[model samples]
Target chain A: MEEVVIQADKLTKKFGDFTAVDAITFQVRKGEIFGFLGANGAGKTTAMRMLCGLSVPTSGEAKVAGFDIYKETESIKKNIGYMSQKFSLYEDLTVVENIRFFGGIYGLTNEQIKNKTQQLIERLGLTSVQKQLVVDLPLGWKQKLSFSIAIIHQPKIVFLDEPTGGVDPLTRRQFWELIYEAAHNGITVFVTTHYMDEAEYCDRLSIMVDGRIKALDTPKNLKAEFEVESMDEVFYKLARQATRAE
Target chain B: MKAVIAENISKQYNGKPAVEKVSFEVDEGEIFGLIGPDGAGKTSIFRILTTLLLPDGGSAQVHHWDVVKDWRAIRNAVGYMPGKFSLYQDLTVEENLHFFATVFNTSIQENYHLIEEIYVQLEPFKNRRAGKLSGGMKQKLALCCALIHKPKVLFLDEPTTGVDPVSRREFWEMLKKLKQQNISIVVSTPYMDEASMCDRIASIQSGSILSIDTPQYLVKNYGNQLFKVKANDRYRLLEVLKSVPSTKSYAFGEYAHISVEKGHQMEASEIRQHLHQNGLTGVEIGDAEVTIEDCFINLLH
Candidate 1:
């Protein structure tokens, strides 16, 4: 049996009179790629915030990386890596400088940071451009570098929020290759994306509708249960049930 | 007759070309799309056509009015919803609509028929501040304001970039309804799947036009025998695919799609045998559905 890195039981968050996340329950196993999916305004962001310890859940219980979300928020932050498409990496910093900066922040020693910087630059084929500013690189390269840097501390889990928006198909696939490599090295991947095709790439998916977990299963099983040929159809069928207009 | 025309339109930023010799035409009442990844010059072309930015080279015309000489006429005759949220965020939904209508020298009542379907949804939130609305609602309000004038041409840039699937579908349906009113819609999106929603699309890259055709024609003309390959071990499968002797093989969703070499009818048994030789078992091979995305990637290659 695989070790469960994340466990949530009846996790709920509320603001004023509105229940943004309504009694959600799920588990993420170690090294597994778990997809958290939902339409906009479906409380995905709120739920993710609660799990990331950025917000306290109004009710219920959850554990992230063996740390209590409420009592051990700082430990949870240390045990997990995070990267969002909207923000990651420093635009003005060179490739090596950014890596070294992140490594230093993650509490790595000089020798460790040096080794990590060299390994990362060589693996990403950034040796030629290591001295160049991050903003000078292409969008694909920037995203890949962001993702690699997020896991520079070798956290047990990484959370990605819409990591591959607006990238070319080839580069998008290459980005997934990096993801697969990370998972192979025993890191849990928790991601949220608007692309249904990307939902298929997950080991297990949970679709949220009206702040509830409407469906959770493997992609093949979800398709079979919904009688659909593709994840897009499965999503359309489920998302149409949303009562909220947005 | 074309509602919009361009010839060798080009633009640059600090000496770096953003759009290079790009040319395309939009027919009256046609829904045309500029499909490409980010930084492909779609917004630059849209800006040039909308007369918001001056092109450095070539020329363009909207409704027979020159983009450079008749900038005021082009601006007044076209409805453009920029890629960003351009509406007055502090204003209420109805106020924003009324403001745009007044600026265009028209009233909401005058073009109520044009945006009645979309406005009805926003009616409930008429008193809500535009900034407080959800992303989908904000997008709807923007569309309503763009169509409030009932212009002959409409320009939407990356309107569905970060939109959810459900909202994206609803947005396209709204565009289809607007098309019935004889609006020549020129929309741009980075999502290749959305290309099919347009009547015709130009797959663009690196500030150049790649191919222009109806979505159906582009997919039908893929001219490749694509097969979906899967196995128990995905990493091993990807490595083995590098030696599959196929024209192209890449990871797509849950499986790797391989387009076999031209004039070669590679049997499933033979491919499975090849994988098994590489110690990859439980391999599955099936026909792959060719989409506009496939065509666009092929064009890039």
Candidate 2:
């Protein structure tokens, strides 16, 4: 049996009187690419933040990579990586400099940071522009490099929130290839995306609507249950149903 | 006559080509889409056509007025809603609408009929700050500001990117209504699903045009038989389907979409029997239609 890398029980988060995440429960298998789907303000970002140790949950219990989210958040932080919707690298820094900065922040030794930066630059085909400013790079390349920097620490799990929000189709596909490569190397991945097609790339996924888990299954099962031909239609059907229920 | 025309249009930023040798024409009353992702030069194209930016190479004419030579005339005849919200944050909804109308030497009451349908939605929020409105409401207000001038052409760039599903549906409906008024539309979007809503679309990638055609024509020429299959162990089922001889498969929801090689027409029963023999149970298979996303994936492959 596969190990459960992430476990949550009735996890809920509320801001003032508004509940962002309400009594949600789910588990992710080790090394699996898990997708978290929801519209804007549907509690996906809130849930991801809680799991990443960036934000505390209002109630319920959760574990990430076998460490309790409530008490072991620091340990959880040390063992996981996070990349937000916007590229989180300094625009004024050179490509190599940005990598070095992130590697240093993760507490790697100078020699280790240097070696990893070289490997990353070559692996991502960024050698030619290694010295160029990040702002000078194309948007696609910037996103790819940001993702590389996010996982540079070799964390057990990496959380990505809308990593390809505004990118084109071709670049988004290439980004997924990089994600799959990481998962193959035994790194668990948790990602959120508004694009339904991107959601289909995950090993398993859960749809959140109105601060609740409406559906949780592999992409194939979710579509079959919804009786839709594509993830977009599945989302449409689920979102409409949620509205009608309200 | 073409409502909008471009001749070898190009744009450069800091000596790097942003849009290179791009040219397209829009017919009167037709909805033309520049379908590409962020930094695919969609915004550059829109800016040039709307007379908001100057092109380094080639010339563009909107309603027979050159973008550079007759900038004033072109600006007066085109309505543009930029990719980013460019309205005043401090201005109220009604105030913003009135300001734009005044800039064009017109009044909200003078051209009220042109924007009546869209403006009514903003009526309730007339006193709300433009920045305080929801994304969908802000979108409507920006559009109203663009149309208050009663322009003959419209240009919208990724107008629904961050908006909700309902708002996106409603926004498209509004565009369809606007199209009926004989105002030519040139819109850009990264979403492939929106391609079908347009009369015609130009598929762009890495600053190049891949294909341009009507959505129906594009789908008809997709040239693949997509099959949807599922079993009790879906994760295992996808692996088995991927290894099947003469099959190109990918997981789509609770089923895997498989396209068998030419001359290989396996039925649903055959697939189910194969799954059963492979230690999989409760297998289900059925025919599936191609979607815009599917076609886009095929093109990428």
Candidate 3:
């Protein structure tokens, strides 16, 4: 049986009177790629922040990697990896240096960092440019490197926020392969993306509309439920139900 | 007649090619899209025609005037919404709109007809500061300000980036209306699906134009026999499919888009047999409809 790696029950967050994230409930299983879908300003970020322990929820509960979101944020932070829309690599550092720096931040031992760095560099075919500063790399290379570093510590779950924005189709394709590999290794991937095609790649998807879970199902089932041929249409059907900020 | 024209327009920054020798033309009342991934030189092309940046070589013309010599005239006749939000954040929406209108020696009342549709959506938030508006509202206000002077041409650079799907739909609808008003529109975007909404498109890469045609034309000649293939183990299926002879495979959404070699017939059985021979089963293969994105990736190869 697959363990529930992440669970949320009536989770809510309100900024002043505006409910940025209303009561929401969902669960992510181990080794699942769970897609958290929403339009910009749809409270997707607010909900993700609450789960990642970056922000406190005004009400309800969530458990990430067996850690309570409110009382065990420090433990939660240690067991889950995170990557945002913005590339978080240090531009001034070389590829190898950047990896070491991130590994160090995750409290990895020098020996573990060295072994993992070599394997990662070889797997990504970055040996030729591993000594080059990250800024000198192409946008695609930088993006791939960022994802690898995010999971350097092999966290049980990884939260990726728009990880493939502004990249070419080939590069985006390659990045998802990395994600599939991670999920194969029993890591839960919780991701949010504006790109609907990326949403289609997930194992299961939950769409938030005006801070509410409007739809939740597998991509195929969601399309069937909405009677659409594509995830884009499914998203369009659900997102338009918003009563605010249309 | 061409509303805008470019002949080998190029620009370099610090000895690196930002926009290599490139050329395209937009016809009057036609919507032209410059489609590519980031750093594909779409912005540089737009800036040159909008008179924001000068070309290092070749030339461009807007409103039948040279870009370099008639920069001021080009600026006056062309409306540009940059890739990023460029409005005054501290000011209210009404103030920003008025400021833009007055900059062109006009008023909102003078050209109210030009942007009435878009402005009405933003009217309720007139008193709210521009920074306080949502992503969709901010873009709408920007479009309103850009259209305040009734420019003959419009250049929108990635205006839908970061916008939600619903707002993106609404924004494109607004653009379609503008095109009907006989205003030539040139938009640059990384969203390949959006390229289909344009009347014609130029697929660009590495500072060069790969293919330029109406979206339908590009898809019709996608350069190979394409098939949509899927299996139970999709990730493994992708790797195994790559090993098949006479094929170029790419991940398109949940399925693998395989472009079989020319004259290969690319029957579903042949592909299924190939995967089955590799101990792979439960394979699904069907002839795929090519999109502008497929054409763009084909050009990349």
Candidate 3 runs further than 4 Å off: B263-265
What lDDT does candidate 2 reach at residue B49? 87
What's the residue-level lDDT of B183 in candidate 1?
87
Instruction: Summarize candidate 2's per-residue lDDT along B259-285 as a digit string, tens digits.
Output: 776667777777777778789987778
The CAPRI category of model 1 is: medium
Best by DockQ: 1
Candidates ranked by DockQ, best first?
Answer: 1, 3, 2
Cα lDDT of candidate 2 equals: 0.83
Cα-based RMSD of candidate 2: 4.5
Q: State the lDDT of candidate 1 residue by residue for B59-88, as single tens digits.
A: 999988999999999888999999899999
Cα deviation at B268, candidate 1, in Å, is: 3.1
The candidate, 1 or 3, that scores higher on lDDT is: 1
Q: Residue A227 in model 1: shift from native, Å?
A: 1.4
> What lDDT is reached at residue B59 by model 1?
94
